[model samples]
Target: MSATGNRAAREFRAEIREWLRAGLTGEYAALRGRGGPGREHEAYPERLAWERHMAAAGWTCIGWPEEYGGRGATLEQQVAFHEEYALADAPARVNHIGEQLLGPTLIAFGTPEQHERFLPPIVAVEELWCQGYSEPDAGSDLSGVRTRAALDGGEWVVNGQKVWTSLAHEADWCFVVARTEPGSVRHAGLSYLLVPMHQPGVEVRPIVQLTGTSEFNEVFFDGARTAAGHVVGAPGDGWRIAMATLGFERGVSTLGQQVGFRRELDALMALARSNGAIGDPLIRDRLVRAWIGLEAMRATALRTMDGVAAGAPGPEASIGKIFWATWHRALGELAMDVRGAASTLTGPGHDLDDWQRLYLFSRSDTIYAGSNEIQRNIIAERVLGLPREPRP
Candidate 1:
């Protein structure tokens, strides 16, 4: 908040803006406005190429310590970078899971050997990561993870299924949460294992979504294996480490996501005007509310970022997950209503246009990462100091 910091932030923002303006042209120009939530399938090879380009330019993992091949950007600087990236319409990043979530977790809890082995590949974009937390039976309640892993020889053999894994098929590694203790239940006796995705025991089946894209997948681990040392933190500490990672999941990148949301809302408002929806009092009111909600979300995200900047996010971070997820879902509804009847029909092959895809994909916005119901529970129990919900 000092004058020096303010000047630095402004300079950083300008530098990022200039870089994006210059770099987004040439081969990457066509990639602008592609590879977001519902559109992860768009220009994937090109996006990977863009990822390597960013790594080379020192733009990837900007929040990580400079010793780890990152910029060691301050929280404000990180926010500025993301906001500028979103404004530039840079392709949605391919390394978000690795860079944002796993990277920080490793920095905090990983051993020196683990850091030396894992951190470089992530910074270099040599290895992609997918989270293995949600299972068919345990979506929001992470403690209910039934996937089991056992040490066999020098490796841990993992066996279970992880559902709704984002980009698992494209990932080289998966950070898996599996039960390591025999007769373990709920949050106990679990281990957070970093498992390789290319081995014979693992299988990835893409789950086609309503938008006709498969950004998420069902990963089956008949006997997936990771080195005994691949476990982050200690055995039975998975719950704590996993909770920290979830906190990271809702960190500064969300500010960037809000920038994207603002752009989407602006487009939706423009659509409403062009389609005469803005002439209607109801549609116009919704658009105004959407804009106001976006501003509020931005403010709240900044307040929350203070905690994220200090260290791994705590329970209060749930506030952000609940707020943004609900807001985005509502925006999707607004997009559909703006489109009116056209939202009902697709061009061909059930192909969805942008608005339609927005509506459909946004439905899961509340569901994934963490569900609204789950988020409310976290806020009530963790943040508000309320009584825990009674389980059946």
Candidate 2:
């Protein structure tokens, strides 16, 4: 970077750092280090308020263009923002699905009317959103979604169930991928529709997790209705748009996520030392390997951002997914080992400690955003020029 660029980057970093220091106070001070991964049930109302506070101050959706209620922050500045937020231990964001995934997807594929209607709320944190892609039968095979939606006069009537939908219970809307054509199958007939969550036809049932929290949910859309104009991109073009949303999912937010990962590893190291787990050569070796893995993840994420900066991330995004998911699951296992006997116990109410919560929550990391098997196939076929897997 040029001297001028370095100066600007430093200024941006300092700006966010100072803002975080000033903002995370009073009621918000207690929100720091709350609400992440398995612990999404913690003080959600407060976190939502904090996010709206951020949006009011022009802090949300910084990567978006200035015309769309964002700061038009460059890739570097956005990275600085997330890094500073995580470093400050600010509350895990409540509107990530809207801000990171759907906002960019709308900017890319939405009509002007849709953009006018949706983007502002996302930027203002007025509405929370959830993704409705996975079904009980589909999980990693998103192409196999059974959720079906058909035009009914001026609206689309949807009927199907979505499983493992994160924050569905709290969302005001959902970006759903459903089959629109009657005879179409697999990737062909899908359409991405933005459906409201507060309707009578939409039922969100929280799926209790091992951590004793219910961030993930089972959402049933029986006769759920969305406006005819709510479909992003053409009716049959949802496969592409959905893939693009997944690409955005692996974008700069992963940098902030890595900061949290580093904090976890650091805390685990301290525990190992205090509890004498560090005396075990195997434990010490795993800790060192975790650190090395985290460094590599960060480097790979920075490299991947170039693709994201240009447009939607390509198949190379799968490499980062596979790397981080495996590393985090392993970190969870290592956390359990670090805690030794205490790992097996819980509080009187069966409440989990941070390490226990980490262990339980990280178990799903590899499975949620495309499984290890699915990511490997993507890397092999798309990134490595391997032949497509034979389909039955």
Candidate 3:
């Protein structure tokens, strides 16, 4: 970047830093460190209010185009925004699915009508969104989805079950990938439908995770209805649109995620020192490796964001997913080791400490989004141009 760009970025950084420092006071002050993966239950109502407060101030969806209720922030500005937000320890966002995933997908693939209806609510945080891609029979193999949706009158009637749906109970809408053609299989005959979540045909059952939290859920959609025009792309083109959404999923917010990782590593190192775990050379070595891994993850993320800036990410996004998921899961293991025997115990009423929650929740990092196995397959087949895996 030129000196002019540097100066602008510094100014942008300072603006957000001052805003966060000033806004995170009174009621918002307690929300600074609340609400994230496995801990979405933390002060959620307040967090929702806080996000709206941000939306009202034009802080949400800064990476989108100005016409789409965003600031039309450049990639550099977006990175600076996320980095400063993390550094401020602001509450984890409540509308990540809508802002980061669906909004971009809509901007790239949605029609004008779709845009006019959806983008404003997302920008305003008026509606929360969730993803409905995984099914009981098809987790990471997205093409194997068995959910079915068919046109009925002027609406699409959806029927299926979606498992491991994050924040489903809280979401007012869901972007679902379902089979639209009767005989279609694999990646064909699918359509991406945006369905409402509060209808009588929709039921959200919370799934208890290792952290004993209900952030993940199983959603049953029976005769759930959406407008005929709610499809993101043309029918039978959902595979492409869904993949694009995944690309957006792996985009800029990851820089903020890395910031949180750095914080976790720092706190764990401090705990190790206090608990004498640092005396163990093996533990010390793991801590050092964790720090090194975080640096590598950040570098890879910045490089990948270039592709995102150009357009939707390609198969190369899988590389960063595999790296961060594996690194975070390992960090969890190291957290347990750092805690020693205390890792096994729980407080009265089975309460878990922050370290324990980290260990348990990080276990799913490799599984959700896309599993390690799925990510490697994507890398081998798509990124590295390896031969396709033999199918039965």
Residue pairs in candidate 3 whose N, alpha carbon or C atoms collide under 3 angstroms: none
Highest lDDT: give the candidate number.
3
**Residue-wise lDDT of candidate 1 within 1-392, one digit each (tens)?**
99999999999999999999999999999999989898999999999999899899988899999888789899889889999999999999999999999999999999999999999999999999999999999999999999999999999999999999999989999999999999988999989999999999999999999888999999999987889999999999999999889988888899999999999999998888899999999989989998999999998888888788788677788888888888898999988888888889888677778888888899998999889899899889988999999987
> Each prediction's Cα lDDT score?
0.92, 0.93, 0.95
TM-score of 1: 0.98
* Candidate order by decreasing lDDT: 3, 2, 1
Report the Cα lDDT for residue 117, model 3.
Answer: 99
Using lDDT as the yardstick, the better of models 1 and 3 is 3
lDDT of 3: 0.95
Per-residue lDDT of 330 in model 3? 97
Candidate 1, which ten residues in sequence have the lowest lDDT sum?
Answer: 312-321
Model 3 bad stretches (over 4 Å): none
TM-score of each: 0.98, 0.99, 0.99
Clashes of each: 0, 0, 0
Tens digits of per-residue lDDT for model 2 on 1-392?
A: 68887788889999999999999999899998999899888999999999999998889999999888889888888899999999999999999999999999999889999989999999989999999999999989899988999999999999999999999989999999999998898899999999999988999899988888899999999898999999999998999999999999999989999999999999999999999999999999999999999999999999899888997789999999999999999999999999898899998888788888889899999999899999999999999999999988
